[model samples]
Target: MAPSSPPLPQFEEAKSTTSTVLWQLYHHRPRSPRAIALSVLTFFVLLYMLNTSSSQSEPNFWTKFPSQHPFPERPEDAQVALPQRNDITINDTLPHDLEKPNPQLHILLPAQRSSRGSCRTITSAMILGYPPPTLIGYGHEAHGTTDFEQMVGRMKRTLAYLEHSRTVKDRDIVLLVDSEDVFFQLPPQVLVTRFQNILRKNNKDLLRKYGVTTVNRPGPKTAPAVVQKYTQRVLFGASKKCHGAHATDPGCVSIPESSLPPDVYGWKTDIHPDGFLNRPRWLNPGTVIGQAADLRLIFKEALRIIEQRQKKNGDEEAFTQIYGRQEVVRELERRRTVSLFKEWGYKLLGISDATNISTINIRLETEHRYEYGIGVDFESELFFNQLLSADDVEWLKYSNVTKTSALQGSMGVPREHRLLLPTDVAALPNPFNYSLLALNQTTLPLWNKTLDKLPNPEDHTWNDIPLMTNAHSASVPVLAHVNGNTKLRNTWWEKMWFFPWARALLRRYVRASQGFDAAQSSLLGGADWWDMRGGRGGVWTDHESWVRFADVCQGQERDLFDDDLGPWGKENGDPDEPVYNEWGNLVYGKEPPQLPQPPQLNDINDHW
Candidate 1:
């Protein structure tokens, strides 16, 4: 204690420093505990607000491809070994291998007699060089169908052909597709393999035992994988919900005109080739493939439903099973009724009997898990009205749902046969998974150059596969659906303003196709649709069909035949006169998008 004093130098130094710190803290504006807590909370709140705003401003899938799964870039030098000049195809521009046929498969298309918009569909098949379709509903005037009667007409004829005719055996694949919109990306063998994979059956042994050319049935009681995976002999898929008039209230069976803009709801008049149609929530029957025997039953059921609906509704044509007529929906709207589905018909009182349906929905395929990306329908984000999330591409299938009490259960679709509503779209009721579109999200993977597991166009360069040189995994949607505002949304414009690549893609396909003058900048003019249809707009190649089919893909289906492109071929400020290199398009410009150096397509490699 004797001077614990006067302390040491180290002690003095520490004391001085401590004093300085205390002086600063004492002089500095000190806050209460509550004030400090509030300040900290405020900083966090500001940070959260900033994050929310930035996320909200991000562009949706409509404009940009998802970062996780971007579009695939085209292979620079993939060459295909296409056959020599053969059958005429789309744009009357493509050369097909019709002379050399794939005898193992039977591709069926119900075409009109040079009347269904310039025979572009048939020409597409011919250009692809697949064998001619059985040709159902030819020569007859198109009375028009509500739910794919053209296909139904062909199905009936095909079934008849299969029932008694010895030509179609169990081994033969019978593919029914939308003639014009879809292009044959690969050969029949490839398609058969895809079908077998979807079927999820052990048909390799049976296939090898019978040989690819000849198909024999397994012994009685032994079900074929074709019948198993392609259950009920049908295949299709569902797309995102379109925010048309019907979406005002998905749970409501009918929406009134008052709930929608005139252009947003069902058209008051029959503006399309087929009138009074009811679109299914799921199951776009654009392209369906199956064995002949099983396919016959699916067609038969569809026909029966059509007949029953026709008889009860008092319409000679227009065959839609579950989806009711425009009048029916309107009447419900007037009544302000709210139900999962609309009634069959006011004229007929009782609920219709349940019918059988064999659908192949890519949207719900358990095997693929419904991966996200564009298919034929490019407006999925718009339809869903939301941006992508981790769970966006969940597995959806018929086994997912339980019951359908209304005509959404038309023909009283059997509980087992009916497409079960996917949980994502079921808020609207009766949402099934049907993506049978030509370029569905599932099917497009075959052409996606981005996926490592799938075969790249470059790997098979100078091989047999018909390479879609213009195919951009991220840029180009598989189906390239001709969709957009079209006077419905603020984004609608005079130009096509749809799947931007539609015209280029179709034109590229025609160029990539064999036989047509590969060198001709603008060989000739197409007869219908947008520009390709000889009217106005920038449609080229078989894009005429692309625009034509857009109407059918509508939500409420306001108009199935709408033409805003002035007069076809005139919308682009060109007089109906065909001119090459107009600006820079292959048709308008002198040079193509740098000759997509894809070689002649032969057959694909053993790679998936």
Candidate 2:
């Protein structure tokens, strides 16, 4: 047997193969049972460590900030890690890029309004006004007085901050809106998606004019997701009607008419009236959205125009005069004409027309709620037409021709004060009298069902928001802008606590922050008062659900109507102290001891 084995194994190939196998095993792996087990254990241990490392799995900054202040959720939370400056930036703590841009969709708000009382209430209203406030919190707030930075300056500064932000990529869309008076009901993603749909349904031919040789190159992309991917650089909110024959269609939106000359909207304000332009299309400074780099170009050009022409015309109106000129130049590019804003350092990356944006809606009101009372300063003539349609709320929003403090419609509210509130609340009040607003027709809603699935549904927060829609389509509105006085008491929205859908959203907010007690003093946050940090604050992100189980406002020792920390003290004792009225409602003072003056001291009759 030994002689036969030796003859078989003597072959050179067999000998070499055995030697190679033994060499590899000896050098690359342990052959012992204990050593092999230990090697397997060591491999698993390293992998476990890597999987749990801070880089792989991290906590939500939304809930992390309150427990630990000042520090970021991660070292790289701020894109560039620049030191914060309160005087120049939004706050002394947050960096320009506090959030990571998964893809794109940047919301920017400029609040130069006074950081005062009812403004705080209105601000809170705007924040809570969104069906799910969570869809919004990731926006920006541009602060400081407007006196130093005119409208143009404010917009430019904010654009500059965004342009340089790490969160912004070349393709990201930057949407500029007035935070004070505006309520965002849909996710920013939906806004962009709708904007794209409007273009496909209306601006296809218009892009051809801008040298898009292919014009929807791949041809027909009807899917919402597909259209959103190809949307243009700029999308302006429609202030004037763009459709002639197809105005009321549900899915098709008529953007600013493509048949008209480029000189009809935005910066091109010089064309003679009449024709398509006769109707006067405008890019209301109210909202403007575009690519980050493109937006930077816009703001930069606007600032240069302001610096060049500030002496000729006030800095405030300069931006309005030159707002849409970039569109004009793009038109010139289409026509192969000379450019004014300079085509250098800029590429025509999908710059396009004003599209009528779509929003979402939920029909909740069934009984048609109404209010009327004596000496009630919070009077609202807010009534909706077409009672069964969800668009009734939109009729209320688009119908308003009255301006908020943004345009100086009130006595003491310096438009900036309405914009400057510490919590960005100043930007939400509509100084324009709600009673005088010219309510409009129904605007389309969006596709997102964010409001459909209520948050913390197991709890009682449903009072704040209820089942608004059984079928959410284009006919409803997702947000409501309460442009009236809510400071004296929870005015317009307070009663919605029992609205057909959900009312607890606002009432719960007041109860949580003791906003009712603080209502007498929300403008000036008191010693124990918590600042929402302008809707972006920790209170909303961390404790909004606290109202479900606990009376969050219980321990606070805030005094109602305290002058130093109050909106108005007992000065002149005319407006009475915060007192319960005949209907068990809180009021400014009882009937004035002195005969009520006609205007300022006038008595109001509002019924609920």
Best by TM-score: 2
Stretches > 4 Å off in candidate 1: 1-103, 115-118, 142-155, 164-166, 183-189, 201-233, 241-281, 311-608
Worst 10 residues of 2 by lDDT: 371-380
Summarize candidate 1's per-residue lDDT along 505-538 as a digit string, tens digits.
Answer: 3322332322233222112211110011121111
For each candidate, what is the lDDT? 0.31, 0.32
Query: What does candidate 2's lDDT look like per residue over 1-608, in tens digits?
Result: 55644445458788899999999988995479988899999998866553442422433221221111111121111121112223422224433434322234444545433223223323343334211121122222345635434555555557556555554566554555554444333223234444444434334444343332221233486432212111233444333322221233211232233332333223433243422222223333445555565556546645665676544333323334333222322332332321212222123443534233343121212222110000000000111111122211221121123522222232222222231111221122321111111121111111113221224433333212321210111122223333332351233333332222222223233223422223222222221122223232212211123111112112111221121321221122333344553576644344436765574333344321
**TM-score of candidate 1 on Cα atoms, chains taken together:** 0.30
- lDDT score for residue 254 of model 1: 27
444: Cα error in model 2, Å: 36
What is the Cα-based TM-score of model 2?
Answer: 0.34
Q: Highest lDDT among the candidates is held by which one?
A: 2
Task: Give the 10-residue window scoring lowest on summed lDDT in candidate 1.
Answer: 469-478
Question: What local lDDT score does residue 99 receive in model 1, on the 0 to 100 scale?
Answer: 27
